[model samples]
Target: MTPRARLGRLLNDALHRVMAEDDSVFVLGGDVADPQGGTFKITAGLAKAYPSRVFGTPVGGAAVLGVANGLALTGEKAIVEIPSGGSVAQSFDQILTMSSRLVSMYGRTLPIHLVVRCLVGSGQGDGAAHGRSPQRHFLGVPDLHLFELSPVHDPGEQLAAAIGLGRPSVFFEPRSLYGRYPLTPRAEPGVEVTGPFGGSRWMRLVVGAGAGGPSGVAAEVTVFCTGGTVARSVRAARALAATGVTVQLFVPSRLFPFDLEPVTGFVGPGSLVSVVDDGPGPAGWAGAVAAALATRLWGTLRKAPVLLASAASVVPAARELEDRVVISSTDIVRRLVRELETP
Candidate 1:
């Protein structure tokens, strides 16, 4: 078997490729320089290779993003790294009020290329402050694209795409997935890029769709998940298959500017659609999808769409307590089973 590629290494490689090709691209974040190489080591060796382009900044999110915005304005592509997703709140003004609104404010489209990368979500017992799912808050914001790194896809491909977007964007890296080693071949550097809307995929399937349901249609369960949640949901979907349940699992790369087109086929009148998110319950990205699909599909759905996300509480550091707050594969399986068993 081929050795799996660690996500961190893929990101490091992507940065090297981008910076080498574009002298205008710069990387800024706390402790991103040599030896430190960033808090998570995702920027490892970047400072050494691109000494002038990659530099560490003082520990202030707002100031860091402010610098990035300034660089973007001057035709330079800036990739700003926030140590944790929670810290992005500190720079909300810089991103939402300043960078994102620049083109609209100027009354014309300007080349404001910026990529804000941060470690997001919870699963590790990192406690409240460090473990936060901030992706939900940025959804639907204009001119500011949102993306999350997936263990299933090539991180290098994703990073290159984000940089090439030439728009203000946020790329989320789930803290727990930094070490994930996906056994996949590396994609051709800069060959195929998805930009903001990075497509979706169906991981599992059931033959002939319907099993049995109240609506006389098959009791098909369709699950939509993103980012770190995709891996866990894959497990749950496979477990459901073992139990003789028909399950369809979908993973979307881009969170904002969401496209419902690709996922329409899997859902039907009798389909039980469930969205799994690692963020806050209901109000997160999963909730947005559930609400939109529910409104659009309306009376056609066998049951109302469901959102499976973290509980409405701070993520605890203790493993047992943390499990209650953060969503898991077991939680997904349990929820689907309960819904399927219901009359």
Candidate 2:
């Protein structure tokens, strides 16, 4: 099945699980009714099934989140679905000041299950406001959990898991992944098992050296990437392999509080490491990884790490312009080959 189908299945499972377990669990969003089903149709049939629990709110993001905060504080689990990261910016004041800071300020033991679902990435032509990924703004906010999904298949399971987890998670569903596949029914509860928050799972390694060295070409470089960029990295790895260069590709499933131990293990003495991300460069996951590696394995390493990220600019409105700015499979291949050949 396609990823879109998986997402729909996951969402259905999540709604069912939340309703069955907690009466307090409610879904609130802007114009997220049936037929239209918000923007992605993830909420389709939800409001119809659970009329009282699932309903639409005003267009104001702050008001929407504020309502959610009130519900959660009063012992209700509220899931507010924002249309995009741009919409989320309007609610930052409430999220940062009230929703996030309440636990410590009031000394209240409030475990709010708030999920802000938003569309990220390009290709939709949603203009600058709708295309931005403002996750960086919520990176370090306390009392809020950030979860990003990049599924090749089984989107429903992933969505169900995100909903059932019951934390204040900012569930970022890539806009590009929607409609990619059909929704599949989940066999078990989506949130039955909770993986490490802010942790990452190694997807694959792309390198020239398979096992033996000396007879095997020397493993010179490693490239780490995630999200839509993983597929690109894999292609780049194959291209590099053709030239007899060893390139290891590390694709992490989780983004925040990224587990760098596995990544650090891959980088040996004198070996070069590069990180590629679809998000903008400046202060992204790439920068964080580089810092961690430098701090953890400074004295023992032979060369400085190289971080490759999208140019620090907003995603373009035009498809061609966006394509150029976004990291491509060819771009990853070229960078890997060049870095490996250097010195």
Candidate 3:
């Protein structure tokens, strides 16, 4: 039997493996050392493994990022973790004007390898202040590789890819998906999936959301999503399938540097394309994707891509109120159904 582990555990193991293989790689974050590990325990045993390299910082995201910038400038790989989703904004300048721009500012002669890992999303009663999905803040930023981890994908591979970019990156870890794992053998059945991302970082799910392979259906609607909204989006796709709508659901691991080639081949004119995200529209990753699609498929797509995202309001702590702000599976189903049904 294949061993199974929670996504969080996989990420922890990945960090251990990464640090073991690369001596230059070290971690810095608040409460990320022994005992506490991290708010999510992603860096559980790093301090014990590499005492000199791993350091726990004060509860200041900006300070951690600033130090990481200095470390990267010295040609060392630094993984800075922002323990809370809402705290990520505190390091905005360090990420935008400093780490991401250092290489270009220095005449592109040197490369700064830094990874800013943020814990994003609501649902733990942490309230609007601590449960915001701030990926939108860094989306489309030049020289910054933006990635959102999916529970169904391999965390080790995703983390390795982000670190291997040889440039600055913002990796969003969805708090809601820490307990999920990849699909089982039964989920695959007879389905076969092939893609440019090696079929691991992304998936070609079938109806019912039991994905380990692709659905050989001529899709009239194509949905692209990532992060915490993946499972919900899949459920929405499954519901849409029940209504006889062919929905092609693609969950990509990387958000920025989004490869539209795979999308372009599957989606065409007269097809309804939708992007589901936890952030608000027109400024978030969904909006960025929609804009890219519109440009790439100029005059080719009949309808503008739809963005199914969170409401443009502070995420409320109340579960009911949070539902209103965060786009739900039912919301996806309803929105896609309406879009498809409309003349």
On TM-score, the leading prediction is 3
Residue 255 of candidate 1: its Cα lDDT? 76
Q: Please give, for residues 246-339, the per-residue lDDT of candidate 3 as tens digits.
A: 6666778888878776556666457788888888766888888888888887676657888888888888889888888888999999988888
**What would the TM-scores of all predictions be?**
0.89, 0.81, 0.92
Model 2 backbone overlap count: 17
Off-target runs (Cα >4 Å) in candidate 1 are 1-3, 183-219
Q: How do the candidates rank by TM-score, highest first?
A: 3, 1, 2
lDDT of 1 by residue, 1-343 (tens): 1235677777778888889999999999899988999988888899988899997998999999989999998899999989887788998889889889875677778888899998888778788888888888888888888888876566777788778887899999997777876522242211111212225332322322342322323537888788788668767876786777666555565677777765564476687889898987878789998998898777877688878988889889898899888889999999989988885
For all candidates, the clash counts are 1, 17, 0
**What lDDT tens digits, residue by residue, belong to model 2 across residues 91-202?**
8888888777655567656566677776676656666788877767777676666666654333444445555554466777667655444312232111111122224655
Q: Candidate 3, which ten residues in sequence have the lowest lDDT sum?
A: 191-200
Query: Which candidate has the top score in lDDT?
Result: 3
Q: Rate the local accuracy (lDDT) of all candidates.
A: 0.77, 0.65, 0.79
lDDT of 2 at 168: 62
